[model samples]
Target chain A: MSPVPVLPAIPGPPLAVNLRSAQLVYGGLTLFDGLDLDLTGGCFTCLLGSSGIGKSSLLRLLAGLTAIGVSGDLRGDDGLPLTGRVAWMAQQDLLLPWLNVLDNVTLGSRLRGERPDRPRALNLLARVGLADAALARPDTLSGGMRQRAALARTLMEDRPVVLMDEPFSGLDALTRLRLQALAAELLIGRTVLLVTHDPLEALRLGGHILVMSGRPAIVQTLPDLPGAPPRDPGDPAVQAAYRAILRLLEVVT
Target chain B: MSAIRRGLATLAGVLLTWQMIIVIGELPPYILPNPWAVAASLGRNAGSLLSHASVTTLEILTGMVLGTMLGSGTALALGYSRRARRWLLPMLIASQAIPVFAIAPLLVLWLGYGMASKIAMTLLIIYFPVTANFYDGLRHVPPGWLDLARVMLPESRRWAVLRHIALPAALPALASGLRIAAAVAPIGAVLGEWVGSSAGLGYLMLHANSRMQVDLMFAALVTLATLAVGLYFAVDAALKRLLPWHPANPETTETG
Candidate 1:
């Protein structure tokens, strides 16, 4: 079968991310040390690792959301600061309970005391299939719907880079697949680094898959597959990649 | 609706019991007035009671406003600066250690016998709970929400995070503190009036008791109780309207 034209090529020159000699220590236990990673920009990279292997911590380091005393040499390809140019989505939807769907989507702008672009926010809500729920409070939505609204908020930032921590982990299989497709389609041109424990999810959504394992975790890239994401789940090539990832994850665990 | 009905029923039962005790014990009006006599007293002294009640109500309201401002302002200051928290937290906790009633005479002495002393008394009683509860709420903003704030907000605009995120997030807690403050506000005002005052239900009750006007004292006591209950409900209703997003039955965890 021909490759589906759902995902457009990432726009502009992708920002490459380089982290060297990164070290994080929590009391007597070392979570990461001498860690090095080179990430291609405008590409979706999925990070797979065992629980407590510091995958989320690595993402935090990249997002500069890590606590103080964390030492690292982190730089973007463009040499510009990565601070305001990146958008992050967490496992929980993290929608402010007080704000309605539309208001949440425009929260960033409102936080900056700028007038929110209501039309753009409404358009994004419509795209997320939540146009009718725009005025509804976030607590009123289901888990999947809340995540979709969160995705709309992430996209509304319109940043060049997006960092997500298990953004679809809480959803059911069907909702997860639908959202993965939507995320791939919507986040096509941005540099995205997603952390997940699901090998199949990583294979389906990521352009590049990296595994972090062992004490003071280190990253290793998996081989690139044939098709672009969202990949055909039934294809043997996808299955082959899936098995390889499963075996690697097994070895790590 | 059912809760209101239950409350009314309970009130009727209490009134019936009070009347029964008075009649069965054959207590004189000075020692224990019957419900009818108290009701008559309330009606007969309505004008005097209303004026005095108004004074106490003003003191409570004024003190509540001032105390809430002082408490929330202090909480915000402490929440934003670690240095402030380290320096002021112990002092705040120590302030609560001294009984507010113990300070009533001192407040009256300092602020004099007018509304200022009564307002100061209520403010003293109210300041601690509002500060403690609101500070807890501000500090306990879900780490996930703060993480989102850090990623989304620039360093220079950090105050925006406090204003938009932390402040609103803490409102439900502040509402609880305000409710508690409203319930106890009258105690301070009445205590100050009892210590030394020209007007208010507290002064009237004291004067009537001294003059053997037992019915008038009962009327003043009833007026004070009504003011306390009314103010509490008013503040509670306002908080519910202001913080509509706060779960009505928050004690139960959501299964979903």
Candidate 2:
């Protein structure tokens, strides 16, 4: 085994996100209207819903990437704006095909015109199990490997809050589960808002669970589970919670 | 090796067909010269043909460089500024509506019947394809990429996103534009020469035809065809090298 660069200590404290009176409309369709959301600092929140329920849109809105027709006052724990302090990972790996894995990991810094921290990026790639592919282009890597590189890139941001939109949904089931475990392990003690379609994925990793549903989508919080996540997917309690969420969403009803 | 063989085979076939047509029609050398007579003229007038070919090549090459630079600058400007898009883009479209041939005579009058007129014609011919294709490419960079760039690098300088992302993303499209530009470059230069030029393959062909030198005219036509084909392939090869990351056709290029 090759020696790995040590992961640097995580930067900044985790930030709780508070959104009040959020309204988002897409082309005359109101996705979220006057919706309020609260996710505690240093905790993981999983948001689940069927397609067109606006789970992804809600995440984008929080990211401040909603270009138009959105109104929200979203803040961190310090009662300041949370616009620049959030790291986002989306369903597609979105690694620039022209850049190698290492360069892609440090893309944020380069784009910001800052000197990239090459060692830290290498360490993150190592932590994500992609150190060997540091110089490889995105198209040369498999989907799972590409997503791993993306995870490394996301971690490179070192922000207080992390938002993921189905970051594992595009992978094969086994790869998705493995990546979920990896993401769960790496993202500990950060304000994380994850949107996923899989109830089991939510059961395994969500510290708190919220279901976004309704005509103008609204969130419904579930009762607290017994322990910290990433909980064992095979655990009976996790299984029970999964079934309950399915029933709640009327997936099997 | 196979590419060379295939090219030689096509050339041989073309020559054979030409010779057969001349022999069967009993055409005189003055009207439709025999392939042998054309080759003889090519050898006899090699010096003149080479000089004229060089002149045309220079015009096309200079035009290619200036046109690409101007077109790329325009695309970036159009992309970078709303004012440029709103004001310049309509004018650009309207200019294209005027047939270039109609303006060729005016350009010859203004720039004179020298290399300037020919080079200007080539630049005019190549500019729009490069601009439109490159601008379209710049505009169509996956929205996800820009969104991500905005989120991650909010403090990026005025042109940081354009430089780092949009420009690189648009290169493949720019290459497509260049391919079209290269193919048409010689046509523009020759068109200018035909309208009015001191020296070029077009001028040589016209002069040869006036003097009843059909074989010399055919030789000049061959020289022009060779220059156009050669220019296209050279540009194609250079593009492939410059954009190694952007393989011409990924699915086909990757056999391993």
Candidate 3:
């Protein structure tokens, strides 16, 4: 358990995201229409919604992982296109089974035909408690371990903005709590937008909690809670915010 | 160990049954040679048989390599381009509808009666299976993986996505195609030799049968079977080694 090294901040100021009049339709079904969202830079924003409420779809739109013909007006705070500046983590780990953990973490660099920074990747893996599993294949890992590896890979990208879609939804309670804390520590000062249905998760990790609901999905920001993320999940203030989020979800759905 | 034992036991049982049929039917040596006679013939004509066997093996190997390369190349092209899928896929499928043996004579006419004609025939036999299986594999990459690729890699790096992600993911499927191609590779070479060839096991079989050398013909048949089975196992072993990430079936562990 060596002390974690300080990660250099991503170059340039974090870029805020703004979506205006964005619409997504599939097979004549409107998933969202004229959706507007303002995500402040360097803030951990968690989106809460019920199943099939277009939470993942909105994240995909922000990450630019949407299918062809998806209509949208998405821009950064600098009024420039937001492509190539995002690191996305999906619900599934999506680690290449053919690659070992070390190679998988360095995938971004390898894909760009640049030499993978192996020491940096190994350091990140150590922070995620996967330093010894660097040579192991993804198929050999358990669900929580795989997600941790995915987190290490995501952090290796060093992108200013990170979009995560229910990254910890499948983990057990204890593992989820531990990973949430690790993610918060590693992703500090980066613009992170995490989509999850867990109200408590939003309270524990998000600085700004937004609930997405309705047929044509819209965003409603939850009341800002006291203290930074990795806050006490059992704290009275955090529990109150959790109840408020559950109630808001109840009314919206 | 059990699988090999079982296979050997089955072969012995079949041989016993064949000998029984010969005994019960009271067939003469000229009409149907017994297993003993075939074995004796194999030993007696080992020299000539070995030469012809080597020629057939060369034809099958050459054709297998060429066919796999062409088939997988075509599959990659079809997988990458919608226009190629629309225009060439149908034609590729239609070509398979025509029996490869039916084109043997034409191949011999064009490529001549040497190893070229036999190799061409084997390649034709192999091309369809390799193309169809590899293309299916390439097309059916897990959607989650593709979505990850879309988010991580920019549009300018599409080639990288295909190379690093799609290609490696599709290898197991390609390996399967290669295995099938190897199994059938002998069929094309033998058929081509039958259509028109001065040498090869198929030609030797025809020549021996014409001269009423039934034992020699039986020996040639045995050699061809051994060659086909041997080639199939070689390819399968190579594929297993190449795809270490592909989990081997737990229920059927390899003892050897």
Complex DockQ per candidate = 0.70, 0.74, 0.73
lDDT of 2 by residue, A1-253 (tens): 7676555555776688999988888899998899999988989999989887777777888887865777888888799988778899999998888889999999999888889999899889889998789999888899999999999999999888899999999999999889999998899888999999889889888999998877788888988788887788889898888888888787776
What local lDDT does model 1 show for residue B61? 94
Q: What is candidate 2's CAPRI-style docking category based on DockQ?
A: medium
Candidates 1 and 2 compared: the better one by DockQ is: 2
What lDDT does model 1 reach? 0.88
- Residue by residue across B1-256, what tens digits does model 2's lDDT show? 5777878998999999999998899888899998888999999999999999999999999999999999999998898889999998987787678777989999999999899998999998999999999999998999888878978976546578887888889999999999999999998899999999889999999999999999999999999999999999899999988887876566776534
Cand. 3 Cα-lDDT: 0.90
lDDT of 1 by residue, A1-253 (tens): 4332232243568787888898878777888899998778888989988777778888888887976446788889877678877789999999999999998999999888889988888878877779889999998999999999999999888777899999999999999999999999888768899999988889899899898877877788998878889998898988988777767766523
Off by over 4 Å in 1: A1-12, A251-253, B250-256
lDDT of 3 by residue, A37-121 (tens): 8889999999999988777878888888766435778899999877888999999899998999999999888887889999999
Work out the TM-score per prediction: 0.93, 0.96, 0.96
For candidate 2, list the clashing residue pairs, or say none.
Answer: none
lDDT of 3 by residue, B1-256 (tens): 6878989998999899989999999999999999999999999999999999999999999999999999999999899999989998998988899998788889999999999999999999999999999999998999888777776776667789888899999999999899899988899999999999999999999999999999999999999999999889889888988888997797796565
* Fnat for each model: 0.63, 0.72, 0.70
In candidate 3 chain B, what residue range of length 10 has the lowest lDDT sum?
Answer: B149-158
